[model samples]
Target: MKSTGFTLETLKAKVQALTRPERFVHILRVAELAQAIAEANGLDAQRAYLAALLHDAARDLPEEELLRLAPPENDVERSHPLAVHGRAARRLAEAWGVTDAEVLDAIEGHVYGVTPDNRIGMAVYVADVSEPGRGVNAEIRELALAGRLEEAYRQAIVSKVTYLKGKGVPVHPRTLLAYDAVLA
Candidate 1:
């Protein structure tokens, strides 16, 4: 993938245009936290911000539109179209000229979970779940801010699985893999 040659302002405007106001607000919050965590962890804050900004680009899109971008391959994504939003967002980002695999992976995996190897993606994942506006996972947020990325990501995945299991919601298969990876 090659650079879209997009300046930050242009990228922001494009994302803002693609997303609903509420969803865009959430994206901004995630981007802020991701950038903070990246800075704290000595990663590329600008890259993290770019990834986070695009992570939820398709979150508010209609199910049909989401499927159109990235068709469901399994029952979870088929029944819960929202599960496909991350993949759709990735495709959308690709179409919009995002060239970084880490960025694209971060955007796609933000909705489920990320590989431990993807440091930027891990930051984005933790930030997405712990960002202030969510009003939950403060400890995880603090850990990430403290540069304890491994611990923060571990806690985030555990919290997610625990919450979903408690609520009787089926955990996405990819999420299960992330959980297992953290445990391993």
Candidate 2:
């Protein structure tokens, strides 16, 4: 478990610089939610906070920068460059010396989903989708906070696909794979 030199104050400044005021607020909420979920589940609360803080670090970057940092790996990402922000955030976090694989995986997997075995990743993913103020996933948030992390993750991924399909958006391959992996 490698830790980076991100003091709470410094991390706030760093993340604030990486995204808009509103987006950073969302990050804060997710970080808080993730930390709570981690504490409930006996995971590393600080690690969960760190991963959530950096999860959307590149979400507000210009599309060109996003493409440069994380080239589209599939048609879904190619069609919606915003879809690659998670991977781009991973690249940025790596550049910033975040060496923990679990943290990196959480950041990268926050946008779509993560493998079920990555407990921290699943927590971050669930938090990202269910953080308070989203007003759309209170049930999922409750599930995560109650230590039903796997169930929360399953519902989150399934809801993502459901929402995307309802909007007629193409499901990201990785999201589909995660959904299947959770079900299987």
- Which ten-residue region of model 1 has the weakest summed lDDT? 1-10
What candidate 2 gets wrong by more than 4 Å, as runs, is: none
Model 2, residue pairs in steric clash: none
lDDT for 88 (candidate 2): 97
lDDT per residue, candidate 1, 1-184, as tens digits?
A: 2367677788788888888898899999999999999999999999999999989888888889999999988888878889999999999888878889989999999988999999999999999999998899999999999999989999999999999999998889999999999999
lDDT score of residue 131 within candidate 1? 90
- TM for candidate 2 is 0.96
Clashing pairs in 1: none
Residue 126, candidate 2: C-alpha displacement in angstroms: 0.9
